[model samples]
Target: MLLSHDITILSPALALEDCEFPAIFNFGDSNSDTGGLAASLILPPPPYGETYFHMPAGRFSDGRLIIDFLAKSLGHPFLSAYLDSLGANFSHGANFATGSSTIRLPNRILPAPGGYSPFTLTIQYSQFLQLKNRSQLIRHRGGIFASLMPKEEYFSKALYTFDIGQNDLGEGFFDNQTLQEVNASVPDIMSKFSTNIKKIYDFGARSFWIHNTGPIGCLPYVLATYPSAQKDEVGCAKSYNEVAQHFNHKLRVAIVQLRKDLPLATFTYVDVYSVKYSLYKEPKRYGFELPLVACCGYGGKYNFNSSAECGGTVEVNGSQIFVGSCKRPSARVNWDGIHYTEAAAKFVFDKISTGAFSDPPFPLKQACHRNLD
Candidate 1:
């Protein structure tokens, strides 16, 4: 049976009477990557989805990610991966998130370590522009927007959500880099990211959900790689998280300043770091355990293998190679080295539904509300 189009894209945001379910255009790293990476390349194996979909679905998690849950909670069905054309739907939204992607191109860190290329975001956006133009042509009798509207509403209301920067921190902190070098680059990184966001805004997206970096130091991969430091430790590469926070602060300020410059623009800052941190602090409440270890892997502590990944068999000695599996993934918070399980994603989405961060200074929901009319 064909699913309701509104069920896939319109319900969640429509539930919020004060907000409009603008076309959701997502851009970011693996944290929100629905399927762009795995579908493109082969890595990170089958057991990755053992507990959820019963098979791999290109997501980093055991099943879905925050983007999927958020889409559901917003009354939209799961978004179609930009790369997959089979059963793909663009009426609701499209996920442009690629694993290991960074806001800046030629990012000094992450990719070589395990992350995808920094240019992933730019590449996806270029694809988005092409798709959008094609869609316009097809729907407007080859006339584009000229035939679709009364000229004033030519540009449809759309929302752009960005969740990037974690890879940068992950690389700088763990991939043989000094804090001094990484910290020094924060200002420049933030500036470049801000510029990218502005570019998207110029592309006809007036509503935005701009996410900051999550608590990188608290990730299982980081925790296991550097176990001596506790979550509360001040100097333990908390510098990475600090950089993310600093960038978020600057982005918030910039968005506010930009509002004055462009009153019609609406920007919302999503504090993903805080939301994820809260879940880590109270895993049981979110139906998770071992928030620091991944459910899929061959390692001892973090459940990750830098040299190896989730799919396909490897040759050991002269013949047979063994694969890894999570005995109980539903109870685990993380799925692979860097992504969370769908259950964990649900917890984060629940917080967003509350509109707890709707106030000024960080106004995500407010931004959505403002553009409803």
Candidate 2:
């Protein structure tokens, strides 16, 4: 485990030795997307990843995600998505997250009652497989593992991070599904995701940083969709957030169990819910102005209009519904109905950089320390 402070900054090659920055392989949903699905799939652009990148970077956010912040904080370069191969070097890391993904093995979302095929976790895993193959090529000089390492040392050193399952809750709750049904099904969904994590671990990933769900109840999309519900308490329709919390709790326990099962592996839990909530409580501390209202969207509470979505037009009451946007997005917390603004993400990065690593058996810094006692 090599701590960032242990690393001596010089050149990229020299930095690798000092930092020992493990190859960062991210697997999750749109929350951690760094431009894989958006580049491949056809969708309304211009709204996503627009804050800093000035264009859709495949991320559902208007800017970077937690993964991007983590990579930079760890002294690693920005991670490239598995789908993006243009001038991208897989020596460092790659992202395998897509929008609308779920943790269930064969997950599917009925966006509009069987209107379109939601991007499933299975598809994301397939993309991850593609990334793994590419990384192998880089390590073994064109897929010849024996050439790079002895038979005994074939496994590579990588840090695999997963941030998924919010979409599962979102689809169920927002699509008029029952909370009882979601609660009953969440554990099974987590089990399937855990299996994939275990598979990655078996494939030689020694370091794992898994994120818990965010405050789904606070999302502008949820708040605006259910105006009649009490804001102080969790919305009745969005009660699936509580179910998400249950899943996250189970995930934490599973991670603990996995650590016991694999003593050599280092696992860290990133409590994104707490982090985001802290920022929302005091946006000024993080240089943010509006934490509740989304920067991009048309009129309503939470700055959201159900008929209008990012990057595309919609018809509302026989009128052309155009989603409006803020002039200075840097002052806002949320970029869209579901994602954060670049400023918000930057603020999140600041929190994670500080003490987020201090929560357990393996703080992020401790996990990265090469000379772990």
Candidate 3:
């Protein structure tokens, strides 16, 4: 309840503080997924966590994720996945994110470990709602695991973070929707996103740190998928990135509306697209190389092959081809075809945490205060 306005926080690429946020309740897709997908789905095999954990640590990157960096900055342990039961400690807060998640449930469903996760935003919220109530009971029950659960007050004081919606756009592409159709769907997608924010707001969330969708076209997957798609000056698909920009524009408008709707809450809409795009546009400026290619992918134009993903093996003429990481992951930007490398993730966190890319122009340390303009 009594949060000091102290502006002393640490960054992971710098771990990111004087503990600006007491706790962080994160929601979204793989961009911030700690381990929800791995717990319920296939575990990311070797080399996924080789750069940091030196083992399969349930992260998609070749090291830590942006969420991990954020936790380090706040001086709190990495948030345990709400779905992870093995050795999870949620005393600070919990992550409700998963890989291949969408704001709204997907229309197309494949049987048994489908293309996308069934743990949609709504489902994640339901899980959080359960935790919110159950933690109250657990704290009072006085069990041994009670210490691992979050305190009742942490819910109200924690930083609410979101880094989702990119997958929703990807789903549209997968469904064979035209670019215009995907562009038209942004409003409805954002509507669902806003509704979820309202639900979390009603549940006592006061400080929000939301990241806008990045340049979807910059990813090797998109580039490979739509070989005929238009390209930007930086060799990314221009139309796809435009759609992402459109989404970010609407997301900002939604934040403005949310600020008015929830008078007591502070909303920071972070512009992660610009920061991410810069990585591709100017990799050398940041000590990065091969910005457009995947560091842990197999052979292809972008070092990515969807059939033979990073850390995966495929048979070629009865011989197995092992997909591994590059020699120096720190020198690369993209991790897998779909995710950013830990180095890139760290670079992104350092820039965004400074509040240079946030709405209302407030740094992460000062994000709790409501912005008047």
lDDT scores of the candidates, listed in order: 0.65, 0.67, 0.88
Extract clashing residue pairs from model 1. 8-76, 8-77, 11-75, 12-74, 12-75, 44-310, 44-311, 45-310, 45-311, 100-116
Q: Compose the digit string of candidate 1's lDDT tens values, residues 213-292.
A: 77776665676677665346322236556666776676677767666766667766677778887766787877777777
Candidate 2 wrongly placed segments (more than 4 Å): 1-19, 105-119, 134-155, 233-241, 314-322, 361-363, 369-373
- Scanning candidate 3 in windows of ten residues, the lowest lDDT window is 7-16
Top-scoring candidate (TM-score): 3
Prediction 2 TM-score vs. true: 0.81
**lDDT by residue (tens digit), candidate 3, 115-206:** 78888999999999999999889889988889988888888889999999998999998788998999899999989999999999999999
Locate the minimum summed-lDDT window of 10 residues in model 1. 145-154
Error of 3 at 107 (Å): 2.2
TM for every model, in the order presented, reads 0.80, 0.81, 0.93
Model 3 stretches astray by more than 4 angstroms: 1-20, 109-114
Candidate 3 Cα deviation (angstroms), residue 6: 19
lDDT value for candidate 1?
0.65
Off by over 4 Å in 1: 1-16, 107-115, 141-155, 227-237, 311-321, 358-367, 371-373
